[model samples]
Target: MNRENAPSTLAADYARAVDDRQFSAMETLMWPEFTQQGPGFSAESRTVFIANLAVLRSFDSTFHLLGQVAGEWQGDQYRGETYCVASHFFQRDGRSLCMDMGIRYQDVIEVRGGEARYLSRDLNVVWQDEREITAPILG
Candidate 1:
């Protein structure tokens, strides 16, 4: 991909990997020193990041990339932002629940040897909703 399109492409691929729960593939897209900082979370390495993803997967979730908000190339580095929507579905005590959120990712990516790797990302939650889909049973 050309320099102008690389960031968006990488972001899209990463979003797809998350949605598919393909942690292995996600590993290839990150730098060895990859880090992510979010509203109330931080991961300083790919291993920890992937492990955090595993926790999210436990809820049975789906992520959708709404769009790439903006992007720019600076030297060998690219900065971009993307909007996303996610839904987490789970059952507790036989009651179904869901948590949905609107999020934005501010990413810094670097191109090395013609491959793009995510150097860092800051995730911000724009909105959220939590609801119970089934009433709790009472004995």
Candidate 2:
């Protein structure tokens, strides 16, 4: 990957990993001291972030990328933003429920030895909704 494009590539890879629930791959993409701050939550370390992701995976959610803004280099780091749409599916009282949310992630990434790593990420939830829906077949 071109040095200038590494951050964008990393962001796309990270989003794919999250959508696929690929924890191990995600681990490789983060710095050991990674931190994340969001609307109502903060992770002080990569461990906590990954653990939180595990919980989210249990909810049977699918994440979709709405768009990604180009990254800008700031000194030795890059900053970027990604917009996402996520839907969580669950069954309660023999009825299906789906919760959808529009989220934005602001990321600060660092490149070391030609590999891009996530240093910090800020998450914002722009909108959300929950509704009852016909249950979709689960494979």
- Error at 27, model 1, angstroms: 1.6
Query: What TM-score fits each model?
Result: 0.85, 0.85
Model 2: lDDT to the true structure = 0.79
Q: What are the root-mean-square deviations of the candidates from the true structure over C-alphas?
A: 4.5, 2.0
Question: Model 2 clash pairs?
Answer: none
Candidate 2's displacement at residue 89, Å, is 1.7
Name the lDDT value of residue 49 in candidate 2: 90
lDDT of 1 by residue, 67-89 (tens): 65688889899888888777777
**Candidate 1 — which pairs collide?**
none
Candidate 2 to truth, TM: 0.85
Model 1 weakest lDDT span, ten residues long: 60-69
